[model samples]
Target: MVLKIGDARSMYRKFKPHLLMVLIQLGYTFLNFITEASFNEGLNPYVYITYRHAVSGFVMLPFAYFLERRIRPKLTWPLFVELFILSLLGVGFTLNAYFASLRYTSPTVVASMVNVISSLTFIIAIPLGMEKLDLKNPRGMAKVIGTLASLAGVTLMTLYKGKSFRSIWSAPIHMGSSSIHENWLKGSILGVASCITWSMWYVMQAYTLERYPAQLSLTTWMSLIGGAQSAVFTVCVEHKPAAWIIGFNIKLWSILYGGIVCSGLIIFIQLWCTKEKGPVFVTMFNPLSTIMVAILAYFVLGEGLYMGSILGGIIIIIGLYLVLWGKENDEEEVPMRSS
Candidate 1:
């Protein structure tokens, strides 16, 4: 069957956000392994965040300047202030807490924590009036129920390790630690805190994107501001010069990848996606990343594939389905800009 140009364009545009989010999840899933490895190699979390923001901001500056030079809005005082707060919430404080959590916890645990971001975001978005969760509406029920199911599944996945599976990995690359119980408690607290900040970031980013429609420029400005904020904090606290050093090692690579791909590109893509599909829509995919990480751990690191994992995966998928149903009911309404 021959397809018309207009039809193909429509199909591409329709599916683009889904494809983009899948790629984002894959990037983050692999990043979990890489960042954890770098942490193990003694890369300090605060220093890592400082460098990460610096790299992303500097790297994306040129692209934003070139592509958005004409369309970028004037940096008004209110807008500047809002963006500054966003930089603080989204980048500086958020990432510092996140990497610190990652330093204490394994990637799988971190990924599991990510499952709650959607629920938290949904709750926040509702009070902000971004989401209309009328229990009367079937759509609202779908979202609410989906979020609860996903959260339950994540709890089960993390808490219940039913059985041990044989090693599917060929190489003996030992990375995970079993004696992380104490650290896990600490990391879980940090992870939950990061999720809360991250959820706030999502809701705030959606609101900010309205007045500042230029995604690339917005990302660049936020990165620069956030990077500066982190750098200042790191300078005050991190006294050792050696901790700040960027040697030819995993530290350098983690900063580059986390900065360029995860931060720069991913943030821009997320901003674009959040613009297209509301903040809650963007966060609903966090569970997918958790599932990917679990599967990867089994095959790559020889981690056990437990019954809870499989059952949790099924529940998570069903939750995603319900959320997708809810998304269909969401009215695509951008917030009116306030004067």
Candidate 2:
């Protein structure tokens, strides 16, 4: 009985990050949905994101200071610079582009597009010597295949919007009809740009975490720096004082939830997961959010569940499993090889 219990505990330890990340992604799906809804209600993307990062920074600062006080390393100038660059790439550019894209497209499109990040990360990591791509190794082959499959799934999702498999009761919120196709093309471009920057951020975070081992502290610093940068941008871009106003509406809710939950909690969870699992492992779960968003959007936004989306989601899921299996196999082999 003791041996069985020990085995169970070991299994739990091994899979705990995976389970935690799944829950986190589900939360993020809901948050993304809310963000889209807020955008439809005419919330300024710049102001919203600025508030998000600022609130997250304030919320996290005390916890990071208290929790990591003893073990936190000295805040050196070079380390500060690295954090600033990370903030610019990850929080500032990635999110600005993401929110901008949402203004032009549906949440479902944005969510499906994000699945490409896994593949992009894999590709970028290989070039950086952060990931191995040995064709002879089954694990490496699996990673390559998984990346290709994910890209293919995303492409299918973008190109084909087939008949609706299921219809919901909610009314669809239309932004506007003027330059709709052009806006969609523009949004797709920006979405891809966000994915690229996000992928870079994952790689940079993995490298940064090795040097600055305090996850909370690092995240706090990133949020603070990114927030300040975003504020500057907001001021320059948004001349009207009305743009910054947050009243009792979806805008207020978006700021509160985006800042507190998405920025603060989600970043902490992501950093912890990235530390435990590699960046690829953490990013592989993005497709799960795409699936969640699809279902949630259908019910809440009265969006149709299309046949193409269903088929694409299945392919994305298969790719996700393949990448995860490859990573797990690689990790298992490391111990044996070392032994």
Best by lDDT: 1
RMSD of 2: 2.3
TM-score of 1: 0.93
lDDT over C-alpha atoms for residue 57 of model 1: 87
Q: Tell me each candidate's TM-score.
A: 0.93, 0.93
lDDT on C-alpha atoms for all candidate structures: 0.86, 0.84
The best candidate by TM-score is 2
- 113-188, model 1: which lDDT tens digit per residue? 9889999999999888888787998887998898888888888898997876766557366675534334767887
**RMSD (Å) per prediction:** 3.2, 2.3
Error of 2 at 3 (Å): 3.4
lDDT score for candidate 2 against the true structure: 0.84
Clash tally, candidates in order: 0, 0
